[model samples]
Target: MQKGSLENHLFRKGQEPLGWELRLKIAIGAARGLAFLHTSEKVIYRDFKASNILLDPVYNAKLSDFGLAKVGPINGNSHVTTRVIGTYGYAAPEYVATVP
Candidate 1:
C-alpha cells in the first residue's frame, strides 16, 4: 500500500476520456477488487466506482472507505429495496436508484 490518492486517477477529476490502456487498467483493477469483495469474501459492495478506489505508487488499486457496507447488502442489493446512501456518480447504478 503506497497510500496514493484516488483523486489523482483519470476518472475522479474527470480529466477527459482516458487513453484506452489507462482506462482499461483502472477498470480492471476496480473489477478485480470488487470481485474479491463480492465473491471471495462473500461480501457485496454497496458502493463502488472511481472515488473510493485509491492507488499505490505503482498505481495498484486499494479499495477504501467502506462506511456503507452491510452484512447482507447495501440498499440497492435488491431491485425494489429503496434506501439509497452513497456518493454521486461513483455509486453503482443499482444502488443509486435506491435513493429516497
Candidate 2:
C-alpha cells in the first residue's frame, strides 16, 4: 500500500484533505471489497474501519487485517450468536445494543 492506511490520509495530522472525487472513489472501492467478503466469500469482516482500509498510490482502497474475520452463518441459519467484539467505537449502535 504505497499510500498507507486511509486513516492516515484522512485523519493524521498534517495530511491534506481528500478531494470529493477521491473520497467517493475510495468509498466505492472499500464497499466493493466488503461486498465481496460478505456475498461471495460468506465471511464477516468484524473490524471495518478507516485504518483497516489501505490505499495504493492511486488511492484505490483495499481491505487489510482480517484478524477478526469470521465465517458467516450457514446451514439455513439466519444468524450466528456470539459475543460482540471489535474496535470500541466502530460497532453499529444497534448491533452493540442487541447482540448481547
Tell me the spans in candidate 2 whose CA falls farther than 4 Å from its real position: 76-79, 97-100
Q: Show model 1 residue runs off by greater than 4 Å.
A: 1-3, 11-19, 73-81, 89-100
- Per residue, candidate 2 scores C-alpha lDDT tens digits across 1-100 of 8999999988889999999999999999999999999999999898999999999989999999999998887998765656888888899897788664
Q: Rate the local accuracy (lDDT) of all candidates.
A: 0.67, 0.91
Query: Which is the leading candidate under lDDT?
Result: 2
RMSD of each: 5.2, 1.9
Per-candidate TM-scores read 0.64, 0.87
Over the stretch 1-100, how does candidate 1's per-residue lDDT look in tens digits?
A: 5745455545445545546776677678888998888776756577675667777776667788788765554465653345776678766797677666
Stretch of 10 with least lDDT, candidate 1: 72-81
